[model samples]
Target chain A: MAFNTGAALMDALVLSVVSNESTYGYKITQDVRSVMDVSESSLYPVLRRLQKDGCLETYDREFAGRNRRYYSITEKGVDQLEDYRVQWREYAEKVDRVLFGGIDDDKN
Target chain B: MTKTEFLSRLAEELKGISAEEREEALNYYSEYLDEAGEENEEAAIEELGGPEKVARIIRANTAQSAQGAQPAAPKAAAEDPFGAAAQPVPPSSAYAQGGQSAQQAQSGPAYTQSGPDDTQSGPAYAQTAPGAPHIPYEGYEAPRRRSYLWLWIILGVICIPVIIGLLGAILGLIGGVIGMLASLIIGGATAAFAGFGLIIKSVFLFSSYPAGALFMMGGGFLTGGLGVLACAFGIWLIRKGVPFVASSIRSGWSYLKGKVRDLRWND
Candidate 1:
């Protein structure tokens, strides 16, 4: 939680959340906050940028009397999320090798 | 402390960014606070770390992303697709199932009813046209969709003389400036031409009259160097002078036009 979550991880985190459920801004912040020590305010711009990137598309659904803007992942977003997953796996493995030094071999 | 104070402070910090962007940010935060509800409003505001901090984050993100990258799914994101389609049915999927439709955040802000719709109208972008996203904020309105056609048409009908006068004045100004620079351009060109001519003559005379040719060559170099300098200066003058002269004429023309208009009004 103390380490910096880079933009890519943030995107992955957001995409994974939205990919699970087409949620609104407040809910997305809450969900992201649940997993990581991130501010609720910072996520708006990320959501906006992701939406601009064609990685996310939004639709307004009337909630009670007011409309809540809901973000849903596009095909592009799904592909991006998959890319992020592969990259994250490779990254984590590399970091682990350097930090833990053949600990897998020792355990085995 | 309250949502209104928090939002206005945020808006002030965000004046530099585009209006559409600012409105969307404000609306998002407003709805965000609304979602937090009455009981938890103070905690929500605290969690957001004050509006000033929120605005700074947004501003930094905005500046970072504005470098030539355009929004990709424009029609999808730019317009309210659900509203535009007029399809009351939601874009139902597995994603929709878990969350269900999010309820409206207007439970009660206490000031909701008495507040002007303009002031408290949550993030609802009034789609004024098919493409233009109009946020119903007091300070920002969608740019007026009006053509200056009548003004142009009247000018076309009655201001033929005025147009001619402007053209004539511009031309006369250009001609006078060119006339001033004409001396230098011609002088430089003439000297350059004569210097080249002498250098060629020196080449021809080197075979027949060596001493005379040497003297001619020395003279040629002297004249040639001065000619080139004058020519460079003249061209520089023309380049700098023309725009200066033209702008002056434009200002003078406008001043005269204003005076004439004043006279007509007084009469």
Candidate 2:
């Protein structure tokens, strides 16, 4: 589904993706693209923002004779992810209730 | 585009970002392309979109996070959230959005916003605030006006002597020519008159006329002295006229030299 992801949501998504395991930029972009129709270019800024906010950390590793940068989620990032989950649950339910009849109710 | 071309374009697009942040961003993107593999470079670039849009996202993200970090200091946050966190970013994005000239014009306001505290200080704030009538006090123009007066004085001093000298030289040249012509005419006439008187005196003496010879001799002597006196006066005119012309020329040259020296000193 196509959706305009807000900054908070983008940050949360990046943090959650990295929280799974430390991953390189291309892999993270591919993972995020599975759910959202965001340009790969848009992910870098979100990654930078999460890093700046202490929710992410980065390190360089060599693979195939070239340097590759990997991003990992920090404790702060996990905390931020928890907050985003709670907020997203409430927000999604509200948006779903308005768009559809009710998120869990039967529809005819 | 090739990886090199894409990275360079991205770097060019991110003009206002700090060196360290820009390096990090570039490193991230470079590694991203590398991870995409050589064969997928083109596809990766196409998926990322243009460098300009990417730069905008990065700049916006940096600005937003900076604001988030310091929520308490509203004043500093308002002054320049982007510049305070990252190195000052010039309004190059305006160029990316518009064109070169438009970006140049926008840079001024962007700088004013990101400039030193003096620009945001109380006095400047009051003067620039909307709906405030700007009234310059009496002393406001003092320094600049006084400098203008000094400039005029120096220019006048340098120019007046040259003007006067030029006028004098022109007048002196004309007067000297006229004086030389007049002196030539007067000297020739007196000399002719003296020669005639001498000839008459010689004729009277040869003819044995005592009284007439004496009268002619007296007239001849008197005419000879008058011719000599006229010649002397002409010589005097030549001497005085030449000096007057020379002095005027010398004065004009000295004034010109002085003007050159003053210009050099000012430089």
Q: Which is the leading candidate under lDDT?
A: 1
Residue A14, model 1, lDDT:
92
lDDT of 2 at B260: 76
The number of clashing residue pairs in each candidate reads 1, 0
Misplaced by over 4 Å in model 2 are A102-108, B65-267
User: Once superposed on the true structure, which residue ranges of model 1 sit more than 4 Å away at CA?
Assistant: A103-108, B69-267
Residue lDDT tens for model 2, B1-267: 888998898899777667887898888888888888899998877766556555655654454334332233223322322221222225445325334334323222221121222121111111111222222221122344456669978999999989899999989988878777577658756775876778676675957887777777777777777776667776677789779978998999999999977865454
lDDT of 2 at B140: 28
Candidate 1 lDDT, A1-108, residue by residue in tens: 213233456667899999998999899988987876555666887799898889999998888777788999999999988877876776687667866887775676
What's model 2's TM-score?
0.45
lDDT for model 2: 0.62
Q: What is the TM-score of chain A in candidate 2?
A: 0.86
